[model samples]
Target: MKRVLFSAPSVRRLLLAALACLSSPAPASDRIQIVTEELPPYNMTEDGRLTGMSTEVVQAVLEEVGVQANIQSMPWARAYDIALNSENVLIYSIARTRQREQLFKWVGIVAPMRWHLYSLPQRNIQLRRLDDARRYQIATVKQDAGEQHLLARGFAIGKNLQSSNKYAHNYEKLTLGRVDLWIANELNARYLARRAGAEVPVPVLSLPDLADDDGLSMAFSLQTSDALVERFRQGLKTVRDNGTYATIAKRWL
Candidate 1:
């Protein structure tokens, strides 16, 4: 080929263009902030490391999509707020609700969760209906799906509802009799109860209205691009199809 060389001015222009590209913001997919809460068997920080069923599944999905993010575990309230106000932020194991349907772009469900009222066996707390829970003090993680669920059903904070930054705090309060009821998923309640080293097992009370089955999913901020959301959705399917989802669940479930 004949020699083709750029003029000095052309070379300068090319250099300037490369600098501009380097200084520009990252693409939406590369800016994702993935967040989760410390819930055993799902997501948690142990021995200064983050690992759990949901964490592994999320990692697998991101790998399938060729995306990477630091999966940080923070208080549920703070994590929830960050996912709500910031662009390119994703919160995992979030319960999908009608009220939140429009607030965020939801990925596929990660796991199934069922909420129940837990109390000490000797407490004899009778919870036949949802309203019945209102008569006693209840503890829940701040800004958690269970807390929102109760709030939507008219549970008042600082009165019948005691919100904590961590589920362990609520379990402690429940075991101490400071809170008459602990609102948590069946798996979480059992996990927290064991972790709390409770001498007596916390028994589940019947709450017909609150017994509905719910699911946890990765929810992206409304500001995230639709293409990125779809990528994650499809990546989740890939993991499930490849049996990675089952393998992760087996490790925890």
Candidate 2:
């Protein structure tokens, strides 16, 4: 039957405490969500563990920054969509293109990439220029750098471009005659071919216009804090400077 009311000063102090708690930032570990796809020699699941050149480099960066986060492997389209829309999500082994410059806060280049249009050796597909290949059906991973690059150059899906969820699936389409050509980076094309116990797809055309010197990079979603992005950028630099990057590259590349 008794009620106690807080004094004005006490109530003010309690309100200020609540405001501070509400405004405080979330912990780094709580905000970061690392995602990547099955891109061989860079990011892939091998022997039931996530291990690759870029994955190792990213792990080193996380250690350097003292952040513990688990990397999840998913379909490239799904991972790309999550990174594009989610807050504090990190995606790796992603090519840095002019089209993607403003989309995310880039950490740094983790590995090299060279785009190419590949086909079966027997097909003898030859192209003197980029547009020459438009006559054939080209397989591309959905939302992948190669696909985006071609799409920017006016390649359309369904008509000429066949979009798939995985790079390996594109390669399969090329080999099975379902698609006349597959656009992929040099390392991924060769790695997937070897894994499939098949001959390396012949590179019929090189896409230098689509390739960037910055290579594939680790990047945080645009919603990520600038401070966190810079922390990762510096962490990546440390690994590159201390010879860790070279060692990892030698193992995979």
* Candidate with best lDDT: 2
lDDT of 1 by residue, 9-85 (tens): 99999999999999977665677999899987688998999987788889999889988689889998889999999
Local accuracy of candidate 2 as per-residue lDDT tens digits, 42-69: 8999888998888999999999988888
Q: For all the candidates, what are their Cα RMSDs to the real structure?
A: 2.9, 5.7
Model 1, TM vs. native? 0.87
How many residue pairs in model 2 have overlapping backbones?
A: 0
Off by over 4 Å in 1: 1-26, 200-203, 206-213
**TM-score per candidate, in order?**
0.87, 0.87
Give the clashing residue pairs of candidate 2, or none: none
Error (Å) of candidate 1 at residue 177 is 1.4
Native-to-model Cα distance after best TM-score fit, residue 148 in candidate 2, in Å:
0.9
